[model samples]
Target chain A: MPSGALLFQSVLLGILLGGLYALLASGLTLYFGIMRVVMIAHSAFLILAAYLGWWLHERAGLDPLLAMLGTVPLFFGAGVLLQRVLLTRLRPATLTMMSVLLTFAIALLIEGLLGYAFTGTQRRVQLGYGSASLEVFGARVAVVKLIAFGLAVVALGTLYVLMKRTRFGWALRATIQHRDAARLLGIDTDRVAGYGFGIGLATAAIGGTALSLDTTIYPSLHWHWIGPLMAIIVVGGLGSVPGAAIAAMVLGMAQSLLQIPMGTTWAQTVFYVALFATLAIRPQGFFGGRLAQRF
Target chain B: MPSGSKVLKLAAVALLAVAVLAFPSIAPNPYILSAGVLVVYYAVLATSWNFVGGFTGYISLGHGALAGLGAYSTGILVAKAGLPPFLALAAAGAFVGLLAVPIGLAALRVRGASFVIVSISLVLILLLVFQSWSSVTGGSRGLVVPRPFQLTRPEHHRIFYFLFAGLLALAVLAWWLIDRSRFGLGLKSIREDEDKAEALGTATYAYKLIVFVVSAVFTALAGGLYALWFGDLDPVFQFSILTGSYLVLMALLGGVRQLFGPVVGALIVGIALEFFKVEYGDTPLHLVATGLLLALVVLFMPDGVLPAIADLIKRFGRSDRTSIREVSAAELREQRLQNAGGTK
Candidate 1:
């Protein structure tokens, strides 16, 4: 058996990584919640954000967080444009089904474009303290991960405030619950969906930057991340933010804990198994709204 | 009575068959014949995928995993169990088809976007499973698929070409039979609206599971065939999401509802894919091209290029004979006057 301190260290590391996971999933759940769009491209956009952050850091000598100042708004604008231009044309009758294919295509487009811009080579956001570790209570914590955790908490906290305190939040929530009903209630549901999509992608900006602190970034990196994010949201009950957040942490911790006994490759199976289990047992998820009879 | 369009379609099918058959003999060298093999492989995969995606309206991005499983099955059976390559492939198909039952049941429970997610997860999980199972699968490094036949390179290509082509014909025939069956009609109704189909007394779940398993079997056969031909089996390439996406793209591009949709789609896409591979050593610009093409297909021609072209042909073919309302009163009067003068 592993030492208790080592277990504690793994738990801490998992939680830190889980924060990053939740940060990315927030956008995906929001898209699903507001417009029923299964944005398969969300991870691709996140990778794009990571590339942007990495580039800015490497070329402009700017901090990745500082790079977010530029990327957040840029990605937001791009998200709004995409949702309005390409996605709005889809009728609600086939939105749920068609969105998956469309976003998948879009994901491929982004991955290809990113690969063209920066070849398929793996890259990490170079943090000066990436290797530095801090000891706390007999557990060693990597400094970069701790910073990534901080970034996630700050971004998620901001998201909490925005969702709770803003007038837009209500409209967003209304649309998420029921688009037609929200429209009947005199809310501009289309506009709400557009902005909500933007906000979801904006969260990806924060997520990508934080993720790059510890993980590698590449165009096809989304392949590895997209599945887990989908699992996270599904387990969290599709579009519920708090549910996804908790699930992300739990799954992350589980994966980390499993990694200690099994090697890293085997650990990846946990998310997929969790996803299958969740869909089979309670597909509406722990916090998902009523399941739609969609096809 | 056979309609004019029906006759035209029959001719088109005959022409496609002749062209497919002639390629192996007329090929200048082995390389072209090998590409022909790839086209047939893709056709078989896409046609198999069409059983579920085309008829049942469930788009699976994880089907490559089914193929990967088939390849692994054949590999393990041949290498570990000492079964002949051909027998191993037959066994592999049955294995994958049986495996699809529970997978389909679990995944088919949730429709639409959720199903897509589950399908993708199925593939990724298999990829992880195969990669980590080092003892059996040989992990990421993969295993050598022993070539059973002792033939020259071109002769080998020609053999597999005909073999894969034979499978394609068999699969297409199966799809055609299913397309006309009561089961197929029920599947289409489910695609249109599962709830309505269920309420109306159709066993929607049973129909979907049956078709899903059938699709998995054909897909597995194609994958196993590819594994045997390529003489190598790896987790990354066998379970590639990109290949799965291509299968979807090919089916969609050809007109999912049509009998020959996937065949046409695979021909066009397979050639284009090969072109890009040759043009750009490995830049992924081809992926961008395919992505743009997919987006265009979804936006402009959801029913696929074949249907779109057929519509245009139908419109043009009947334009002059479409309606009597197109005749002006003056032209009608002139026609009547001309008829009277001619009678006099």
Candidate 2:
């Protein structure tokens, strides 16, 4: 019953939102792919990055995009330390369970810390172009969202290159494919895992910063994001990068399209419904890999 | 393993149950009695969660949704349908239990981490639905639950304390019965290894679904009771992910596979949380403390504090016995030498 132009507009919005979701999910999928750790705290790190960007902007008058210069490296280092210090020491038999618990606890820790500092007040980064929109195909597209999409594409492109072109990328890929074989080939997998985790978190930093451009964030906001983010990655297949990217777009578009008929509130149900349908029909996910049965 | 030890253990358990039952009698005031009700509420929730989480090894992060559904189910029945509150509570449990079947069927197919993801999504979806559907759920304004009976404030608190305690006992009894049942062993086999369990002819799916529904029913009852006791209900508080997190934390912190693990875990966490709330008033400090405790438990004592303490006791016992063995061996050799001298 909706007009063609309205449908096009929804699709466009979905794609842009999906782009941000892709950025959020990329690190989560990457961590799972290589480390076999589900990284439930991925959104918490994203929130932390968002908070960091907000702080930098408020205190130093730095642009949020510029604030990433400080935020990304900090989260990157924390991710590496988390891997080396906590994750690596878990017993193999209980690794999956422990990692889930550990990351969940870390999420709580981050949320509680943020709550302590900010007192559950929702904060957003105010930008010059925040309300500015550009006309595209008779649809008004927000400038901040377009910039977010652009930034996400750039980050994902860089990640693609890093995973495919670099020697470290090869080592990372090799560790994921066959851990024992990669270790036999003298790959310093421990270091590679640390770097992989770092790269994963760095993506979260980029995503989080991009998110702050448009969205209001609070300490417990991670709970809202974590579910959808996981749904994206899982629907794409757990550890597959391309799968996650594609699934993120699909979910975004579906959510947007649903808004046409169901309105905004009910449209949010699309993610979980899609996730449930995906698991029921194809537990291996759309890309179909080893289903991470380690737990 | 001895009969005497078994009898002693049973006696200790009975004594603890009796102490808990009699707690409301000695409470200083209505405040403490209300706190006792909270502890019982958590014990029921945690133990119910353990049915699927601890036994079946399928961690359900959305169980609070079931509890929420139960609360709403009872609330709607009592407020809208004008049913008796007690009758509504039982009906709510049944309704939630039946609801779990379709949910479990969809969610239980996935294993390990995927299962966790699905479970979490279930809770999130329910939260969204309940929040948006204002006509049925009363939206954010929430619904007022009618108290089943009219009584003085102290009497009201005391009655709910006993009521919740009775539910906790039922939950514990269910867990105990399942712990010794063949069906429970099948569930445990699935926990240990699903494929092997299936290959060995266990109906793993059926067992899991049954337990999950059972868990849902009990959890729903607890929620209904909570609604009745509080005389008010909000979607957010009833269906909080924090509640789910606490349930998981309690089971793990106590000793997942142990019989009294959930109760012990709930008691510690519940009392500590209440204490923190009283001391700090309204702050996020309790959540921080909880997070720290959970992290420490998972990192250092994955088997849980109870199990770790039991191991420590066993270790000390072994060392003492080993030292005694060495002394006795030396004494035996000296006696043999003396006997040889006597023969000469």
Candidate 3:
């Protein structure tokens, strides 16, 4: 219903948005792939990292990008400790339920602490580049978004190389494909799980920083994150990083295009409807292989 | 001596029932009475949830959506169709039960974690639907249901308290009947091993459907009661994830297999939340506390508080007779054979 130029712009914006979404979902899918943990509290962690970035930027007058240097490692360590201390104790058969409860608890704890510290007020990180835009094919694209997309592509590319080339990456991949067999091969699954959780949390830091630059955030942003993240993971096939990337792009385009005709709220509804339909038709997901193994 | 113990147990139950019935009358304050109403409402919801989750091992996260469906239906009927409050409540329950059929069909085919995921997705989808369909469903602002009875506000609170308490009692009785019935055994068998049960000709799908519908109906009744008590309805309040979590928490905190586990869990958690709210105002600390408690319970007392307490009581009392009944291997095998033969 819209003009060709307008539609093209929307698609471009959607692709840029999708790139960031893919980065966020990549961490979640990768964690699930290796450890069989869904990490329901992932959104909470992402929001927490965003809050941390906002705090450092506002209080210390540090740039948001530099703030991540401190937050990412701290989050990674916390993730490793979480997997080693708490998640490791739960039995494999009951891992899904236990992880759900554990992550839920973590989310609640984070939300409580954040609420206490920051109150429920919304805050945004303001970089000098926040308002800057560039002309691309006659459509204005925000400078921050462009930077974020580039960062996501680079990060994802690094992750891809890490998974395919390095010995640790092979170990991680082997664990994902066959954890028990990998364990039998003396891979030290505990170490792998700890690192996998760290990697997942580290990705959240990247996503949080990028997202805070784009929009206002509050503790309640976790609620908004879970649905879309879940949709991406479901569409991409759980644990498939490439699948997640493609799914994010598709969802982003669908949502943006729908927004033109249906408006924002309806557009959101259509995205979820598509997610639900896709899940119902193929629970294994768009590119899900033999990974149909239960969490 | 065993007969005497049984008599004592029955007497204790009767006294507890009488006390609960007279609570609103004896309590002077409106807040306490309202809390009592909430406890009853939660008891009904949690106990109904146990039918499928506790007994059948389905662990549905979408029960809250079914409850919302019932509440909204009652809201529409009372507000637009000009139906009486009580009739609307019954109709709401029926409607929600019917709605559960297709969702159950699609989801019940999966096992364990997949089932949980499907249930959660169903609730999320329902929430989206409820929020988007504003013209008929009142959108996000929600429809306000008019008070049906003419009484003082405090008196109205008392009336609803007793009404919910009655419903809670009815729900408990229904669960008790189901637990003692052959149907309950069949469900338990399915939970333990669906493939094995199917091999024995248990008709697992049919039984699961029945349990799902029954659970939905009772949960819907609780929702209807909630609508009446709140005198309003909102999509967020009705179909929230918190509602689902509360149901799961209550069921888990109490021994899921026990008839009164959910009731006890609801009461304890409800009282705990009230205490926290009074102490800390409206901070999110109460949710944090619940989350901590849930994690601790799962980690240490996986069987829940009731069973743990029961075990403690048995140990201190040193009563051999109080030990749980155990079936020997041969007897279990014979029962299985009998079940298989009966099915054939």
Taking all chains together, each candidate's TM-score versus the true structure is: 0.94, 0.93, 0.91
Task: For candidate 3, write residues A1-295 as lDDT tens digits.
Answer: 6888888889988999889889989998877786667777888988998898899999998887888899889989998998899888775535666677677768777887888899989898878888999988888889988878887888788889988999999998888888889999999987997898898898888888877778899876686677777778877777788898999898988888888998876677655665566655776778877775332
Backbone-clash count (model 2): 0
Candidate closer to the true structure by lDDT (higher is better), 1 or 2: 1
Query: Higher-DockQ candidate among 2 and 3?
Result: 2
Q: Model 2: DockQ against the native?
A: 0.41
Q: State the lDDT of candidate 1 residue by residue for B186-251, as single tens digits.
A: 988877767788999999878988999999999999999998898888898887888889998999
How would you encode candidate 1's per-residue C-alpha lDDT over A1-295 as one tens digit per residue?
9999989989998999899999988988898887778899999888888898889989998888899899999989988988999898764445676778889999999999999989989998777887999999999998888888998899899889888889888888888888789889999988888898899999888888887777888888898999999989888887789989999999999999999999788898899988888777876777776743342
Q: lDDT values of the candidates? A: 0.87, 0.86, 0.81
| Tens-digit lDDT string for candidate 2 (A48-81) | 9899888888888789999888888988999899
Q: How does residue B101 of candidate 2 score in lDDT? A: 88
Every prediction: chain A TM-score: 0.95, 0.97, 0.96
Provide per-model DockQ scores.
Answer: 0.38, 0.41, 0.30
For model 2, residues B1-344, the per-residue Cα lDDT tens digits are: 57655797899899988999889999999999999899889999999999998787777777788888888999999999999999999999999988888778767766667867877887788888989999988988999988888899889999999899899889989999998889888888887778888899998778888999999999999999998998888888877887888988998899888778988999999998899888998787767887888888888877677878877987876543334321222245568889999999
Where model 1 places Cα greater than 4 Å from the true spot, the runs are: A292-295, B319-344
Look at candidate 1 and give me any clashing residue pairs: none
Off by over 4 Å in 2: A292-295, B318-344
DockQ pick, better of 1 and 2: 2
Please list the Cα RMSD from the true structure of every candidate, rounded to 1 decimal place: 7.2, 7.2, 5.1
> Evaluated with lDDT, which candidate comes out highest?
1
Task: State in Å the error of residue B267, model 1.
Answer: 0.6
